[model samples]
Target: MFDIYNIGSLILTLSILYLSANKYHRLLKLERLENAGASPEEYNAYDKRLRLECILLIVIMGTATILSQFTNALTVAVFMIILGIILKIIINKCCPIPK
Candidate 1:
């Protein structure tokens, strides 16, 4: 029986996966730049920042997936929404795009 929680989870999961895919492509691009002789320290720093963003997306995806299985649908939805917001703030503060 599909319900609102399932729909929400589906939307959240798809969007997070899209973000992850974009980040993965970017990492590939970053690797190409590094191979083309970008500075080692700077390249690694940018690579690490990109990785942290990926990790955040994965964490949210995992949380949404797991919580959707439980009984308290309302709580899970609210918690995930709040968690997403908090993580977004952290991402903005911690992961500034490299110039």
Candidate 2:
């Protein structure tokens, strides 16, 4: 049975996962920019923000996954996998690599 807590937890979990993936993707892009000789000053602020967001997302996702076990492990796992795919879609939409 789905309750408010379970529903909220699911939403929060998916959000954190997507955000974490997004931040990591951005970090990779930053590295590519650096390799391509982009100025550090130009990318530094975004680099810092992405790293911080990635760290925060790791903590949030870990805690959420642990807490989710108390409710339903299989359901949470399925949701996480589905949300991961959704995150991939979002990342593609949010950041298409320059051709």
Candidate 3:
């Protein structure tokens, strides 16, 4: 009893989270007023944001894994993971966000 809908949902959830977190971080970095040089403050701030992104990604993926097990929808789960990865690649490849 594989449910594609659930898989799609999981995939959509992860993709949204990753895309949004990335956008938010990028925007924040862009907002920085520093010029010509990097400082400890900037490095720490960037590191913190990067850690947050990693945490969120792991949480989302873990949730998806749990949902897949409960729903017994391996196909859907795999599809969702693949779709998310593909979309991420496409976005990175096509849109550099004009830095």
* Highest-scoring model, TM-score: 1
Tell me the whole-model lDDT of each prediction, alpha carbons only. Answer: 0.73, 0.64, 0.61
Candidate 2 off by > 4 Å: 1-33, 36-69
Error of 3 at 8 (Å): 22
The window of 10 residues in a row where model 3 has the poorest summed lDDT is 90-99
Against the hidden reference, what TM-scores do the models get? 0.49, 0.41, 0.36
lDDT for model 1 comes to 0.73
User: Per-residue lDDT for 12-80 in model 3, tens only?
Assistant: 777777777777876666457344455656655655555554555655475666566566677657755
Q: After superposition, which runs of candidate 3 have C-alpha atoms over 4 Å from their true positions?
A: 1-36, 72-99
lDDT of 2 by residue, 1-99 (tens): 436676567757777678877867996889897888876565765566565555555554654466475667776677656665665565556544434
Q: When superposed on Cα atoms, how far off is each prediction in RMSD? A: 6.2, 7.5, 8.9
User: Could you tell me the C-alpha RMSD of candidate 3 in Å?
Assistant: 8.9
Q: Model 1 — which ten-residue stretch has the worst lDDT? A: 1-10
Rank all candidate structures by their TM-score, best first, as comma-separated numbers. Answer: 1, 2, 3
